[model samples]
Target: MENKKRIPNWLKIIALLIFIIGGYFGWTAYTTFLASNVTDNQKYLYINTGDTYLQVLQKIKDQKIVEDPNSFDRAAKYQNYTESVKPGRYALTPGMNNRRFIGNLRGGYQDAVKFRFENIRLKENFAGKLAENFEADSITFLKLLNDENLAKSYGFTKDNFIAMFIPNTYELYWNTAPEKLFARFHDEWKKFWTKDRLAKAKAINLTPQEVSSLAAIVKGEALHKDEMPAIAGLYLNRLQKGMLLQADPTVIFATQDFTIRRVLNKHLRTDNPYNTYIYKGLPPGPIMMPSIVAIDAVLNYKHHDYIYMCAKEDFSGYHAFATNVAEHQINARKFQKALDERNIKK
Candidate 1:
């Protein structure tokens, strides 16, 4: 038999060394790219608009979202996430590998925020809320809301623009731009005004905006949902007779002192156009964001001859309706006496 050339000891040692080194590097790569790197607890990562990759990394580090920062950095660089940062609100789940995390950041795989707003009293307040949830700042949202040309494009005046935002919960991406957000609201408003709703508006001789404004008044006055239709009807009667709405809520809004529990003569004397006691028609716009129930109440208001309303004396959040001054005065007196008893001076 031909003797096989014995492998050289030096060569065998070199080959073994190479195999060991390769295995070590392979294990390192596996840990860096495939092993769980995220913290055990779930967390949310908010990357604001115009954020650089370094800022995003710092946010991750500060939040302690990753179990091994070095591994995450290595995976991020390998996946080219450093150059492909996207603005968003992202969810970091437990047991997420660095590769998956970097991939989500690179691909803009973000979570939607459950955004909800109601009873917002001012555009600034709305803006602040938007800023609190979105990547855009409050000033950015305010600028969009105050842009006359932008409002006109959406068939809304700056004063009535808030009416477009129906009070409800929405699924919105946190990176939504101000213009896109306004467009989304306008889309929702259009969706709300179906053919049936449009016909109802026409029957009442009120535009959708007018309905929203009246609904806001109805919302402010009636705390009980069952009483909304009656209150809405009362206001409709006043509107038909060209009577001053004379709504105390309007005076409260005009005074901009939301703490006023009682609308005194001084409050009614506020000179702003929102003071329905001073202005003839529905104030320039809604005093507050109205609920869907309130808006529907205006659309389906009860037909009645009553032209006046007074909050009930028992503080039951119900109202007393009246057709004439004498009846209204009786109801008003009862309520005034209740207020005096409670020592509600404002």
Candidate 2:
């Protein structure tokens, strides 16, 4: 009994206090780590290429996503996430804690960015759009695209490199390199030109690039999708006859004046290789980015004897086809008269 009394009340109180303090600290740490520490308003975090740990923490703080950045920092350090910074778009939701957030960064569970483009007209515009959507800048992308040797290695010229990109949506990492982007396009191009497509191209006696070029011309000449096949056929007829394409769209391209409502005799004499009237063949490159519909239209061109076409006098976006020069001239005269009446002199 005396030995039992040797265990004093003050020592017992000290042991109880120690246990309570340890439990409180442990509960606080568990809440900070395992429990939700993210604000309800927080949704996502964007980690750019080559971001350091501090930058990531600052971005989290700036976005007001994390309630305790210090706790997150400690977790990240413990998980060795501070050294491995993954660059990408990350998905976050409300009520996420330091454990989950750090685990995502450490495991590199980033969201894939959706990439897409359409109706692009100019190379610069294409480059700018790509830059806006990707990590690469416009100048760097343009330079790589225009590298003649690099393009030749891919069996394309700088002029026809635009053909490699088929207009569609793609999923890729936000921090994809410029070279990787080019390779992805190349792969997509290969996938697009399947055996059946290759056979169709062979039957038409045109390379894929040539088909895309003609498709661009066809797309430029017609605003209505239904007219593409017939316009493609008309141009094919002219090509077969060894005659000038004489496509007004090519003249507009040569003049670089998209605002011209009418192609006059003066515009046709621009003397550029893109001027189909003077070149007597396909242009060296596409006049604009062609749609997949336009490309398929060229491949499945309607068999027709028509060699001429003119925009109809009606303001509706349609065209009139002619099998002979006389009919074509009449159609042209009618269109010119309509233009004159509308005071569209340019």
Candidate 3:
């Protein structure tokens, strides 16, 4: 057999050097693009609207989501994520590599926030709450709510716009714009008013807005869910008889002093239109964002001749119903005596 030619020493050395250098680069690339770079902890990255890429990087650094900031920055730049930053709430999971993280940021792969609003007493409070979970500021949401033209477009007045927002949990992106959010609420409101519900409103000779307003009053008065229908019926009776609602909750809303445990004569005398004792019909809008339970109670109210309601003396959160002035006075006296015993003189 012919003898194999031995490779030159210098050429062997060069080949070995090339192999070592290539292996080192390949390992570095794997660490930067494929190896787990995110910390092994659950973390959320909130990128606000108009945020710069550098700001987003700073947020990541602040949250301590990534193991190496330089490697993440390198991956972001390589994937052109620095030029295509998207505003959103993103979830950073364990074992996430820089490549996948940068891809998510560039592709707008964001997580949805579980948004819930209920028992909100005022539009300002609602706006503030929205701002807490969203990229938009409170002022932005308030401006949209107060926009008369925008409200009119959705078939609602600025005062009654709160009625459109049904109290429930929703899945919404954190960066949803104010206009889109309002549209979503309007869509939900429409979904709530089915044909059967519309027919019920017509039977009661009330609009959906009116029902919502009454439901808010019912909610404020009745502490127990079982008593909501009776309270709603009482208010309906007062409405039909052209009697003042005289709802104490309305007076509380009018006074804007939520700490008042007792509705005194002074509270009743509040000059605001929301004071049902002063106004003849339901106030301009709902006093609060009524619950679905209260709204349904108004739609299916308990029919009765009783026109007056007084909280029971035992503070059991139940009410005593009466048909005549004498019985109502008796119930009122019992409640008043209880209040006096407790020294609740607000």
Listed in order, each prediction's TM-score against the native is 0.94, 0.91, 0.95
For model 3, state the Cα shift of residue 138 in Å: 0.7
lDDT for 161 in candidate 3 is: 86
RMSD of 2: 2.9
Q: Which residue pairs does candidate 1 place in steric collision?
A: none
Better of 2 and 3 by TM-score: 3
- Give all candidates' CA lDDT scores: 0.91, 0.87, 0.92
- Number of clashing pairs, model 2? 0
**Residue range 175-272, candidate 3, lDDT tens digits:** 99888988998999999999999899889989999999999999999899999999999999999999999999999999999999989888888899
lDDT per residue, candidate 1, 226-330, as tens digits? 999999999999999999999998999898899999889988788999999999999999999899999999999999999988889999999888999999999
**Would you list the clashing residue pairs of candidate 3?**
none
Better of 2 and 3 by lDDT: 3
Worst 10 residues of 3 by lDDT: 40-49
Error of 2 at 71 (Å): 2.5
